[model samples]
Target chain A: MKSTWMMRAFALASLFMAGSAWAEVVVKIGFAGPLSGPIAHLGKDEEYGARLALEDANAAGLTLGGEKVRFELVAEDDQADPRTATTVAQRLVDLGVRGVVGHVTSGAAIPASRIYDQAGIPHVTPSATSPKLTQQGYRTSFRVIANDLQQGTAMARYAADTLKLRKVAIIDDRTAYGQGLADAFAEAGRKLGIEVVGREFTNDKATDFMAILTRVKARQPEALFYGGMDPQGGPLLRQMRQLGMNTQFLGGDGACTAEMLKLAGPALKEGAYCTQSGLPKTKMPGGEAFFARFKKRFNMDVQLYAPYSYDATNALIQAIKTAGSADPARYLPALQTIRFNGITGPIAFDERGDVREGGVTLFRFENGAWVAVP
Target chain B: MDILLQQIVNGLVVGSVYALIALGYTMVYGILGLINFAHGEVLMIGALTALQTLGVLERIAPDLGPLAQLAIALGVAVPVCMTLGFLMERLAYRRLRNAPRLAPLITAIGVSFLLQTVAMILWGRNYHTFPQLIPTTPLEPVSGVFITPVQITIVVVSALMMAGLLVLVNRTRLGRAMRATAENHRVASLMGVDVNAIIGATFVIGAGLAAVAGVMFASNYGIAHYAMGFLPGLKAFTAAVLGGIGNLGGAMLGGIVLGLVESLGAGYIEHLSFGFLNSSYQDIFAFIILGLVLIFRPTGLLGERVSDRA
Candidate 1:
């Protein structure tokens, strides 16, 4: 009698589980970035941000088309390589991910954007800032951050108007993002009457910059602008100091990271400046609460792009809710015209799928941290 | 003129580390006729081990002097790398001694990849800032030219080590046994030279040099990562081949010459290419020289012993 009673309880539990599973619809969102490399910390930050957003969405217990919905995140490592990005994108598509929030570096995102477009899956990039990504006119490609043009213009304006710098040199790591930002900065600097004394290029994997710095030093520019991430930027600044250049240093969002302060160490001084693609975190709409919650969840401080990533993931989910379907075909239009207030700010995409009202902020290294220049 | 001097100084510092690593490749090739492709990974292991030691030293003895801490780290790294080298020879190369040449070469590559993967798991993918035990403050040895104390240390230390190695090989009784083993293992064994011991000693000595080179490389650049050894390792291999794979003096000379060529190439590539290219083409100079050397002087500079042995 006891055995029969236990068997009946097991049968009832299994039936309940089956019924619930049938009633709930599982939706997968893909996230791809460099998860194992020098810049992996930044990639992981973005992934965790997306994860938190999904967790929050799941907890809200929303119903889509009268069925309870569940959200799942599928992550892939692209290693920040363009070739690997395409393969990861195809893999995500094959895995039936309804949408993607990924390909952090512009080099990876631009190439992977073609894959998502071909597969008819929409992808929103949280950190990639190269203008060409959206210029390609792919309906599936959307960006939630300010492009390189805005960042470069803001930096050049600050350099000319505020710092009153007359001449500067430029260096790039030769990735799509680096080169694009460097070119945009050069163009804007010319318009602002700031002479670009020199331009040099290096690869993303390089650690040594003595040779190039020596060449740039000969030009004797008052300031130097480097368009690359912190990995290269840190060493470059150190080498520049070693060469005794003592010139002011400027960089874009790629180098405007908390990691830069640690990597550059003592070389990052008062003269070092960078431009981030959005307002400072303290100025964001829900910045304080987000920071406390993020720290509680991950036991780490937010890196550069986490807030934007969180907003992008939420934007996708919001679109799915408005469309009342998880199908990419059903939600693509909704995503294109979606409007919502995000942790970063108000979010709405324009005709080219670039985020509207995107703002840029300038920061300077002060007291060993990036301080907003106001 | 000042720019030229700075580039040359930079080249010499980088070349010294390459020469040190190349010695390991050359010595192993001389004795066992093996390229020891994983030799670079040994250098990487040495650097990371030193970095790990430094971390522990910081926690346990935070008040230690920088130089003393560095010495302790090197002391630990050298022995660890030596044991690793001996184990690699005993377990991997000894069994493949009679296999086809391609087999050992492939095995060396596999071992290299394995070491990198293992390092990745242990250290994770973040680039650790190698503590600058030696101060990086620049000193102007000449007007308009900057040289850091770390650079001077690298050059001076590499020269001392290379000179010591030369004396050991040329003057010691054990060196005589090593030379005998390299000439003919079967004949050396018949003559009671203890061929196995000499080969093992060769790997140990090479690994010791690699450890020093690895530490110096990280110190000069101020960063350490798992994949840091690949490029330097390949370049050092090119140096060994360029200097004549079996020759010690040739390895040193090839490394310095290659470094100079790369630095000068990067410094002037813009003017040479009429602005069509930049210093990003710096890596091309090494391969170009390697190609030219292989085509014209297959025996390499100072390479009289390679053809006679094999």
Candidate 2:
């Protein structure tokens, strides 16, 4: 009788959990990113893109095995810290989410991915491009953005072919994301026959780079590439200008933001180069209406990563509709088959779950705006 | 040889800034016989004041020359910082003067938190680029060395400030009074030295110097934020202790020596052997130096007799 009671109690607890989770017909997807920091704009933009996809998918009436299903979105702020990412991931798991769409920046995503992997949940990153994130070969992890290899190569090519840089200086914030991008760029620059002159490292919270700048000015590299976000990048730009380092800077999408321009001061933005994924404002895919609605809803400017996030969430929703089940293991193959066209260009995934037909645009800070490379 | 020379130049520029900030911490300690743990926060406030002034000036006249902008910053940061320094002493430190030493230490910590929270609430949790005052171009003609005008300015200005301080402490009446108060406050009070007035003046002067250092640091770095003072504060304290806590000269020497050791340890010495040390561990080196100094000579390089004894 005691054994029977224990079994029954365990069964009841699971049933309660399942019952509560399945109580809602909506398919819930979890999103995570640093929503409040130096690089928060990227996370904010990603949230935007995900929100649009959700609205459109819900309007289209999601289906699973020809049955109607609803979709819901849940977002958490990781604040760009690794430990916080783990905590947020656990919260989503405890909430019984079917799938997740973030853990932006490899620093946060690397630690958080472990929780989802153990729980057998599918997580797709739209913006995190760190090579190590995928090098571990986790089945649960996916990224829609091109990795450091792609962006780094593009950065090198731009410097050598277009910018005509013969030598360049490199600085990294020593984060997995920053270091990864910088290493890739340095390797690519070397292969392109561009001289890699000076290399420097800084901490995440460091604001002063004068000593480093003074050193860089001495080297007189034709260009500088800083692999960090707006907080560090903006100040570096301003200091470079103040220090009279006339060389242009080429950085990843991490430095591409209104916040960066504002932080660097308007004058310093001139002659800087940045590479970001997807379409520019004029060339957005089904983005004309999205931009208008985003501005109206958020009452602020739209950011770069929001489009990718929208696609990631919408793609997950579409997959759940086709699979007709919340079990990601059984349902994720349908997601792997995600070929639907959505915001930030058409959304699709390869064997590694990276975006198939994606490339980064090399943009320059001209006047006060980021202009696509001519 | 060239790399080593370059690194030395780097250390000197950085060391001078460290010296200026360290003096502020030491002076406050010398006067009150208590560690003003909020000294770092005082530096943060100075940066914010300069930032606000720059913003207002830039908006009012975008074409204003850099010199004009700097003038505006001086006007804004000076009055604001002096008032802040005076008010903080009166409101926070004054009441706890007669309390146990630990109480004032605790109050200083609370004041640090209060200042940090106020900064966060007002500035929003984001990175704002602080205006740059110094030109960052590298200076040449040293043949084997690469240095910048800004670095030279740092060394020169810091040395000059330290010199001025020495004269102020040794050659002036207020200095005499301050030294007497620090030596024995009750006795000094009996002697009509106006103990309260001296303490208040000490805070104001220390804050003014910190403001100048804050501006220099921000201008060099190109940005400032709410949490800027945390690490630097800890480093300045270590400098004070390493130099022999109660001595002004010791603090300046300690700061420069610490900077030189770290830069050389990382740049030249790190690669010499099995590759244990590097620039990344430069911060760690400072603490190690401090620990060694404490273990060997806790009173610091100089005697801890109050400034009056010197």
Candidate 3:
């Protein structure tokens, strides 16, 4: 019986090899993220991440059912819009991709994930942090970034315990991402015994923030948290200085840009705090090497989420390697077991696709640049 | 009292810009009875011209004084706007001289899009920050609220320009010709009033006013981009319509009203239980107001019936 089983295994192995030679067995991976628009820097970094990881895996060869295979990356540009995200997701499905590592913005990821779920494709989002993403309870869905709930609490802890602030005002751009972060910060501040003095709303396109700042000024808040991108935040900082309400500013990663100095003008003085997912570049394990190569390749400061994108891509590619198949059905469970060290930090994801050891960085706007706060 | 005072100062600063652009819209509409949709794009070009001129000046004389920089910006802006205004009339609207009313308006839109595309290619989509033209530090903070010198400069300069425009339109002999041309182009041409020259003059003034507003906008904001004119243009159009589309005084009034409404809207919105109408919807508020005025008061607050001769 044992000899018969050994003969059967040998026969199966030869058959697989013959099939591989004839079929040129390949598993395609789909990566959808923002690749263009005002917030495009992060998306480009993400695409590069997928490319690096897949390239490495393809170099070593994918072992599926103990047969050699190749990996293909199918990248789609969502332009950071939700409607575009759904169309891209559907296109990837029609192409019969195995899995996906994508979705930069929560607004886009939430709607796009539904398409992936229906198609039975597991997708891991490296950056979408809105809590409602996991609340949907889709089996094929997962998020790798620290959610708003965690980030909001952490920011609040920093403000209350670290900064020792008393009263604070918060404003949101009224979009999904901006409002989500705002609500989280507000809730955390209240929980941490900080007086939530005032809250205001503005559009993402606005340049004049005098009215909002003036209103917040009346309340005399010690700090103002602006939940928006650098485009709006920069001008707000400048106007705040010009308006003579020289209060401290707290913001999320959206405000983490060198351009903010130009936007806010001379008022981008020292002590403005910004929080972002993952360790600072100088803190990441393989950050310096990635930065060196990226700077050499891109000829610019890897300006946004290049590090996170790099790691997210490597993690997805590794899962394909261990599973040795392109079938997401075969590799997704294996993907959940990812325990790899990434450029951003240690890469691990829960069954829901959220990162297990999600990290964040804190920095301050000082002397015309974002100086990482120790 | 202090909050209200601070809000008023904020309103006046932005209102000055709204009024300047509105004056341009009103002047063109008053003379030609044609809404120049491309006025905003012309404004953007004027701004880019100013930016380029300042850049050259900065390169040539890095330590140039503020007066010299302002002079160079104006020098570049004036001629560019004049040439742009001349070409727009000759190329785009001239063909539609005898077409239906909608024809010239559609041409204006095409011209607007064309200019926007050109701007995107020339300037790229990213916002470019210009060097600070005005001192930005606030003068003082009284009762924890204050206004900047730039705000005062904006209000004062806009007021002076408006006052000069009023004198030019009402008191000058050239103003009489313009009024005659606007009243009846065919009759005025037959009467030897030089209707075409008056029309060209109107373009030059409107284009020039738009340039001034563009310069002020870039100076205060520290940046300019291709789409910078869009929101400001919409608000200024609203200002023109609200004050009475063809009435010069009405445009100024409309601008101040819109600015106040925008500033007060945020305050009132925050006071609302749910903030259903926050600052995010400020532009929408202006549009809504425009729609309501068109629906109920088509002639607007100070508009005169065309049948009633001035």
Best by lDDT: 1
Could you say which candidate leads in DockQ? 1
DockQ score of each predicted structure, in the order shown: 0.69, 0.27, 0.39
Candidate 3 chain A lowest-lDDT run of ten: A34-43
Clashing pairs in 1: none
Local error of candidate 1 at B31, Å?
2.5
Please list the C-alpha lDDT of all candidates, in the order they appear: 0.91, 0.78, 0.80
Winning candidate number (TM-score): 1
- DockQ comparison, 1 vs 2, better candidate: 1
lDDT value, candidate 1, whole model: 0.91
* Model 3 pairs whose backbones collide: A63-A324, A64-A324, A142-A352, A142-A353, A143-A353, A143-A354, A144-A355, A234-A264, A278-A359
Give the winner by TM-score: 1 or 2: 1
> What TM-score does prediction 2 earn?
0.82
For DockQ, candidate 1 versus 3, the one ahead is 1
Stretches of candidate 3 off by over 4 Å are A1-37, A41-79, A83-101, A120-123, A327-331, B97-107, B141-145, B171-177, B193-200, B270-292, B305-310
Fill in the DockQ of model 3: 0.39
